[model samples]
Target: MVQNWSVFVSVSSFLLLLLLSKFILRKTRQHKSLPPSPPSYPIIGHLHLIKEPVHRVLQQLSYKYGPIFALQFGSCPILVISSPTAVEECFTKYDIIFANRPHLLFFKHINYNSTTIGSAPYGPHWRNLRGFTTLEIFSPTKLNTFLSIRQEEIRSLVKNLYSYSQQSFAKVEMKSRLSELSFNIIMRMVAGKGYFGAEVEDYEESRVFRRVIGEVFALGGASNPGDFLPPLQ
Candidate 1:
């Protein structure tokens, strides 16, 4: 019993020491100079400064802080560049430094543990994913095979629009119809079926795919508290 207690205490002490070292290292690294930034609140940082029309808000901030400025959005440190020259420099001169993505939980859970191309860190694995996707999924030959599917979707969109227009100058909402057409077309090309709206080939698979897509969109739009607050995660 005494030996077990001693072992537990030793493990706890080691973990505490490791956490302390990590915090100290982070603070030490933060001494590196960053771009000009507005005053930020603790914990939430500059997240509250955001307002409607994100582009306009960014413009306002650029006007105040200069063309290039830093912002803390929750726990994330963002570098905003409004200047075309600066943006060009970042992508050209410093592309490799900025290639890595943050290790977000959404990427881990939704992206098969950051294995997906978009979420994966820049490395051999990411390069392979990109190569595979480009060659197999998005190659011209592959897309050419799906030409009929695209035409079918476009015809469906046109038919739906014409149906609405048959009556005296009816206001036809094309946005939803266009989106539906695009989704159906892509799904049909990829899976040989649709997962959303009409003409879904596999009902059970469509239901699952629809729910997954809905969840993905919702989670993408809604901020995760655990992202900013590590303790919550």
Candidate 2:
């Protein structure tokens, strides 16, 4: 009977503490102006409100909350803008302010500690990288040197399509084919060889490249739990 009474007291104390903390937090936030946010749980925040087909869910939220609203996913605060005018203002007028990439785990590890052009924050390092790519890689003179590579890849794609179509109308998956075509063209230009299609110099190396790149593309766009949840990180 004594143990049961103690357990009840402990539970009551925990609930009281939770309530007090929430009240304090609410009072603290009342001083600042934040965008309209749906009610969120303490730790997980609005994470539980999100579902698959995220774009659709966000659209529905936009209808209820208006063009601009805020969300909390774990410890991270997110600003969702559904207005084209707001998007334009962010990209054009305040581009520099929004240029920094989010510090995600994938960028930390896979992108060589966030130093790559895509992962790096906006600053001198990024400017240097951009300048180098502009002058050395994407310059007209440099692209002209790889003109034959592009032409050859396009011809190969057409020939493959023709051959496949000759034997009745077989459904060609353009998405994968186009992906391979683009990847092969880029790899050939960068490494002096393609990693996809039948023209690969090393089959094993090409297999590894395909697998690693496929995983990168798959994971790059995924909403990782570690990215938002500090405990998970």
Candidate 3:
């Protein structure tokens, strides 16, 4: 009887949460002019409506709600645009309005308080970062100066591949090799030393660099539930 009562209480509490969230959502909607959105639940909102093959699901939603629509994922509101003209206009006319990236937990922790070029908000800092990259880092002269590093890395990769397949045909994991080449080139250019490839001088440093890079890439594109749910945050 006690176990059953506990379960009953839990269910009642969840129902209350749902009802309260629904009331809050309704009140907010009354004040703001949100884009056309499909029916959504209270707390979870359109999260439950999303399925695998995300693009196909989005295409179906577009068919139902038109080229541009809105979706609520927990407390976050998302705008979906499917029309080419709308996309062009967004990037051209209203680029500044939509320039900022969404604030995510991974970015906050891994990105030095979101001050890096990739995670910085759209403002004076972002503009300075853009200008720096354009003129200092990615400029044609800068790229040309790094040409020897790229050439050396590519040659080393070819030599390694040839050595592996010299005796007999060998299957190489191109993905990892390519990733190493890219990292090695970037490290050599930025730090004047390659942490990857045969030229690595310090194994410990290489291991740490590889580990950090792996973590950065792994968390970069991952979605945190805390980002959407304020209570979780």
Number of the top-ranking candidate, with TM-score as the measure: 2
Q: 1-233, model 2: which lDDT tens digit per residue?
A: 99999999999999968966875586358526778888887667799999989999999999999999988887677889999999999999999998999889999989999999999999999999999999999999999999999999999999989999997988888998899899988998988899889878899999999999989989897888988876588
| Better model by lDDT: candidate 1 vs candidate 2 | 2
- Rank the models by TM-score, top first: 2, 3, 1
Q: Per-residue alpha-carbon lDDT of model 1 for 78-195, expressed as tens digits?
A: 8899999988987999999989998888998889999999899999999999999899879999888888988988887777778778876788777777777888988787777777
Regions more than 4 Å wrong, model 3: 1-32, 167-170
Task: Report the C-alpha lDDT of model 3 over 22-119, residue by residue, as the tens digit.
Answer: 85767486536876888877678789988887999999999999999999888787999999999999999999888999888888898888898999
Residue pairs with backbone atoms closer than 3 Å in model 3 (clashes): none
Q: Positional deviation of 212 in candidate 2, in angstroms? A: 1.1
Q: Pick the candidate with the highest lDDT.
A: 2
Candidate 2, residue 162: Cα displacement in angstroms equals 0.9
lDDT of predicted model 1: 0.82
